[model samples]
Target: MSAGRHGRHEPVYRALELIANGLVRAQRLDLHVTGLENIPDTGGAVLCVNHTGYVDFLPLALGVQRAGRRTRFLIKSEVMDIGIMRFLVNHTRTVPVDRSRGAEAYRAALGRLREGYIVAVYPEATISRSFELKEFKSGAVRMAAEAGVPIIPAIVWGAHRQWTKGGARNMGRSRLPVHVRYGLPFTPGPDESPERETLRLRETMNSMLLEVQDSYGPHPPGEFWVPSRLGGAAPTPQEAAVIEADEALRKAEARAKRAADRARSRGSRR
Candidate 1:
């Protein structure tokens, strides 16, 4: 069965909460949450989160559940394509974002917000390989502005150790430390530009992340999944920037070489 056309995911969402609760217990994951009361209990709002790892979603969902509200995440369309997972995701009222047609997802999110439901958006758009906060996209702020709802910034630290884009796997760690903190909800300033609003959101998120990291104690030694700032093997933000720049240079060189090779071949043929 699917969620009602009106977008109610209740009973099923409640069930999802139960399952999430069980998963936390079974996995022996340690979750630390703060500022959850900032989530508006009776109105539409946007939860803007940082993208760290694949496993991060569960904790974020649990945080929202604990806040006494049901939330629909803006998930990748590819996840909804999974045959078995599609049914569950659909009934949970998650919004599917086709990268090519991102506007549709924005509209769906706005619609949900208008219906007085909570919507979660990852402003980074994708997981950061460096396990650090990435540049923010304007989507979250745009949605909140257009929907006339407040935006709550949520930062989750430590999930990157479980599974990250860098391919580090530390899921076997018992009682893995994870912290989720929600910042106070704030609405966009009147006539605020998307870039300005996004910048504000990014600052709030990064600050929250740093606070969580500070209180969580030192990270696991020699773990590639840990952020470099915490003494792990993950690259620092500066290192990641250099790596990205080097990659762009390498790709440019390869394209130039290919073009030259093609030119030489055409000349020879002539």
Candidate 2:
């Protein structure tokens, strides 16, 4: 869903307003967005969120839309396959990513930000079984560093509980309280190593997550474990298992996808 796909960008502004208003009405959840002033009234910027629950996406976008800005997400290809979602995202300038192709995703993400659209991507790239931040993928760090835009750290709380541990999927009209918090944008230091960039971003995200969580009284157990600093040790063994599984699944999926693509190409050539 490239920004250029849509002709005449006027509808995008009105449409986002409708979507944001609808999301707030339907969810009936309270939202408190801090540092809203930090977001430049206009221009391209990256909003990095902690991915946990399904509702997190809407909350993340709602914050951007609320601040009177258009948001483009570097999302999964599967999401784009949905008819309504694809239409909405395309009009909004989202870049759908097939993680199997890292280089392609990078190019697409960079392209959107360069085009003066606010972009969002999750550093962890997947939800945590336990509500603790996992070791982040370097994508957010790389994208933010290369794009050279203010990366705003956002945190979402309460969406994780909407999922039942058994299915851990689908919340059909489920009533879940949600909170969104945005942190002041920060510039990654000059000559920063990928490691440093990743860690710095992680720490900012961690703080924002904590602030959002704390705002929702009665902490969701284990939210306290993520330190105020980035690249900190992961949670305990029980929690680490989920993070490990997420990593392994992502790697396996990426490999399988590439293999399939190569096989298809070879067959086509034959």
Model 1, 1-270: lDDT tens digits are 221122234677677778878878877888998998798867788888888789888898788877667778887788876886798777777898887798787888888888887888888876776778889889788878888899999988877767776665766636888899999999998687999989998998888888888898777776786788777887888888777677779979998999999999999999
TM-score between candidate 2 and the true structure: 0.75
Q: Give the Å error, residue 25, model 1.
A: 0.1
Q: Could you give the C-alpha RMSD of every candidate to the true structure, in order shown?
A: 5.9, 5.7
| Model 2: pairs clashing at backbone N, Cα or C within 3 Å | none
What TM-score, computed on C-alpha atoms, does each candidate reach? Answer: 0.83, 0.75
The superposed Cα distance between candidate 1 and the true structure at residue 220, in angstroms, equals: 4.3
In the range 111-148, model 2's lDDT, one tens digit per residue, is 87777677888888776645567778887767777878
